[model samples]
Every structure is written in structure tokens, then in C-alpha cells.
Target: TQLLEQSPQFLSIQEGENLTVYCNSSSVFSSLQWYRQEPGEGPVLLVTVVTGGEVKKLKRLTFQFGDARKDSSLHITAAQPGDTGLYLCAGYTGANSKLTFGKGITLSVRP
Candidate 1:
């Protein structure tokens, strides 16, 4: 099984909609980060929660880390086309320091 998996690899919605993408794993992590990347740009860090049960919110986006530190979630409220992009979740552990990325969720919000 994959180390990390995300649901709904693709999402399409009208302007002013709401949606959520989930990241799940069987292995625990020291910390997990959420990132949003636009075409031709690097993935920008949206949120990073290290403690279990931690939650962070940025404008219309909400982030949550599972109590077991094995999963995370991102929820968007009143999503606009401007909010459209590639949503990715990454987990970090050990000396590798390499992030395990989700298959990627492509969100397209149309007006």
C-alpha cells in the first residue's frame, strides 16, 4: 500500500462553492504540511501542523491534523476560481527529510 493517499484526484466546481480534500496514511508522521501550487510556480506552504489534533486556518482554507498524526485534511469555504490550483499534502519523518506527496488534487473553480 502507498504511504499516503488522497481522495478525489480531481475536483470541478462553480464559483462560490465549497470542497474538501483528504490525506490518509497508515504510518505516523512528525509533521505534515499543506501546499498549493499554481502553474509555473513552486508549491507554497499553506499550513504546517506538528502536534496531533492541531488545526490551522487561512482565510477560506481550513487545515486539520489527525490525532494519530497519520492523516490530514484541507477544507475550502466559498471557493473561487482564484482558489483553483493543485492542492498537495506532504509528510515528513526521519533523516530522509523528503516529503511524501499526495497524488495531487486538481481543483478547477469556474465562474
Candidate 2:
């Protein structure tokens, strides 16, 4: 099985729409980080939930960690055109700081 997978590789919606991106894996990770990246610039860390069942919110974005640290989700509320970018979830093995990333979900929010 793939190390990590993401659902709905691509999504396009109008402004004010709601959407959820999923990341899944069979292996457990020490910590997982969620990032939102735009063209050119590197990804910016959105949040990192280390504890199981942990939930974090940043503005209109909501992030949750699975009870087993094998999965995670990102939900966007009333998404706007500015929300359009690449959403990536990365799992760390706790050594060398190397990260395994999901396929990624590309979102396009039209105004």
C-alpha cells in the first residue's frame, strides 16, 4: 500500500463553499503537519497536532488528527479564491526530520 494517500486530487468550487481534504496512511507517525502552499513560495505550516484526537482551528480551516495518528483531515469553511492552493499533509518518522507527504489536494475557489 502507498505510504500516504489523499482524496479528491483536484477540487473546484465557487466562493463561500465548504470542502474537506483527507489524508490516510497505514503506518503510525510521531507527528503530522498540515501545510498550505502557493505558487513559487514554499509551503507554510498550518498546524501540527501531535496528540491523538487533537483538533486545531486556524481561521476558517479546521484540522483533526486520528486516534491512531494514521490519518488526518482539513476542512475549510466558506472557502474563498484566496484559499486556492496546494494542501499537503506530511508524516514524520521522528528521525532526520524527514517527512512523507500525501499525494496532495489542489483546490480552486472561484470568485
Candidate 3:
């Protein structure tokens, strides 16, 4: 089984600040996904990067896949209070495999 680790497991920032969270694994992944978890609900998929060195943007959030495809990062610009939540990263080997999840970073953005 592959393991994913996220750094700076907790983050607290003021509104409108820019921040970046990382997810890493020694094992190479075929693809990686970013998700945001809300209170009393499961994570919601935000984006998936299949190709190495690919970057995807969703509003103020940017997702990137490392060149080796063993790591990923989520960067948020001008973060708002609404962005405060638990962010998760999941790696996929293939269609038949299970999702390898990181412990996730809990963000607290004070307005």
C-alpha cells in the first residue's frame, strides 16, 4: 500500500492571504486528485491531474502535479474565510485500485 503525507498539517491565516499546501509520496502515482471536505460531509473532488508537470486552476486555487508524479501541491491565492476547511489529496494507481489519501490539512482563515 502506498502512503501519502501532507506537510504543515494545520494552517491558520487571515483572509486574503496566499498559501500553499503540499502532499507527497515516495511511490509514483498514475494520477492525483484534490478534494475539499466540508462539515458533516465527505470530500468533494476539486480537480485531477493525470499528466506529470500539469497545472490546473480553479478560481483562486491552483493544483499542480510534480514532474515525477509522486507529489502534488495546492495553492490558494487571496484566500477567503469561505476557503477554510479540510483539504485532501488522493492518489490513484488505476481504475481497479483504491484511493491512497493524505492525512489532509485543516485550514482556518479568519476574516
Best by TM-score: 3
Clashes of each: 0, 0, 0
What are the per-model C-alpha RMSD values against the true structure? 1.2, 1.2, 1.5
Q: What is the C-alpha lDDT of each candidate?
A: 0.91, 0.91, 0.93
Candidate 2 overall lDDT versus native = 0.91
Q: Which of the two candidates, 1 or 3, achieves a greater TM-score against the reference?
A: 3
Residue-wise C-alpha lDDT for candidate 1, range 58-103, written one tens digit per residue: 9999999999999999999999989999998899976578988877
Q: Give the alpha carbon lDDT tens digit for every residue of 1-111 in model 3.
A: 438999779999999999999999998999999999989999999999999999999999999999999999999999999999999999987565888899999999999
> Which digits, one per residue and each the tens of the lDDT, describe model 2 over residues 14-97?
999999999998888899999889999899999998998999999999999999999999999999999999999998865668
TM-score of each: 0.93, 0.94, 0.95
Residue 29's lDDT within candidate 3 is: 93
Which candidate ranks first by lDDT, i.e. highest? 3
lDDT over C-alpha atoms for residue 6 of model 3: 91
Count clashing pairs, candidate 3.
0
